[model samples]
Target: MANPWHALEGVQVSDLGEKYFLFKFFKEVDIHRVIIGSPWTFKNHLLILHRIHENEDPLSIPLVLADWWVQIHYLPPGFIKESMALLFGNFIGKFLDYAMKNLSNGYKNFMHIQVQIDVRKPLKKKKKIMLSESNLRKI
Candidate 1:
């Protein structure tokens, strides 16, 4: 089905009808799923897949950072910037979790997940780059 997330403002869905599909439920197009079949190629940059299920047969929608950036860059002037950061961070975290749990396996190359946080007070120095390794070390 056509990517539900792609339907979001400013995000583009490639290969529609040719590879992707748009399914209707209850005559509403908003509640459909985006299914990426196997043998997919994640060109340059990270190939992010948001896992929707845990069963052997699951649906993974392909996402890219560039596309996300485009969406964020084109956001309406009235929208708060923090909202974009939060969405991007959440997407990054979810994508990283999925990759570490699923795609990182059976691979020789090592992968890393990085998260940025601004924990200091408003008058603080700057934001912090909290690597995922630090959390794992603590555990």
Candidate 2:
């Protein structure tokens, strides 16, 4: 685990008993890096990480959220901006980051953004967005 994380100051991983473990990082940047680079797997099983907050129950806190990069395809020409991608991402889940470099790919067919989502929840395959009552686009 520490090998893949590549923490600058190294990390201390402790077994918190049964399915749970604690990760101690020397820098906040390391923690941020790990959290952003989510949906990790070891031998095909998902590894969930949650930052233990002050006064929070380690065992009781739910660990269902994971950061995912979603590619929005077939977007209309007018909806390719960062703001629009953010709106669509927020509609799907909590928006994290947008692929700024991919803002205008060949033909402007897709937009990619990272969002934090609950793995336990079923994701929507398609959604209809109404910019106004007169304009509706299915994404």
Candidate 3:
């Protein structure tokens, strides 16, 4: 049977040499149907077969389970900077949550902790630093 999804332009799908797949798209497109439908069908088939062989050795059960994950990368015309900032904020939040849980004792007496983030535009020209005579001699 011919796969209809093969006709999609700017879309590339490749196996990751494991139980994972990498789907890349060059432009914005709706891929919700493919993502939601394919994994369920494959996993459901595994589940059905597992049930049929209920008497199989328990140690071999994990080998028959089907697991899949999808990671989407979408870069629009002007949203790259905004998306990167959002991702950075998410990472910081997760890191703080983990640190607070593990190092709770260090912050127990503090009323509040303030975090300041400075974001500035990069300079077009690089500035050279002048070295003192003594510093040059040490080098």
TM-score of each: 0.17, 0.76, 0.22
Instruction: Give a tens-digit lDDT track for model 2, residues 1-94.
Output: 8899899999998887878888899999999999878878877988888889999878887788888888888776677788887888888888
Q: Model 1 off-target regions past 4 Å?
A: 1-26, 29-31, 34-136
Which predicted model would earn the best lDDT? 2
Shift of residue 107 alpha carbon in model 2, Å: 4.5
Candidate 2 clashes between residue pairs 3 or more apart in a chain or in different chains? none
Q: Per-residue CA lDDT of candidate 1, range 1-139, in tens? A: 2342344432333444434432323322333332222212334323334333446222344433221211223222232234435544454432212122123455323222223222231212223444466654543
**Candidate 2 or 1, higher TM-score:** 2
- lDDT of candidate 2 at residue 87, scale 0 to 100: 89
Alpha-carbon shift of residue 133 in model 2 (angstroms): 12
Could you tell me which 10 consecutive residues in candidate 3 have the lowest summed lDDT?
93-102
lDDT (10s digit) by residue, model 3, range 28-93:
342544433333344334221122134654334333322222121332223223333344333322
Question: Candidate 2: deviation at residue 63, Å?
Answer: 0.5
Candidate order by decreasing TM-score: 2, 3, 1
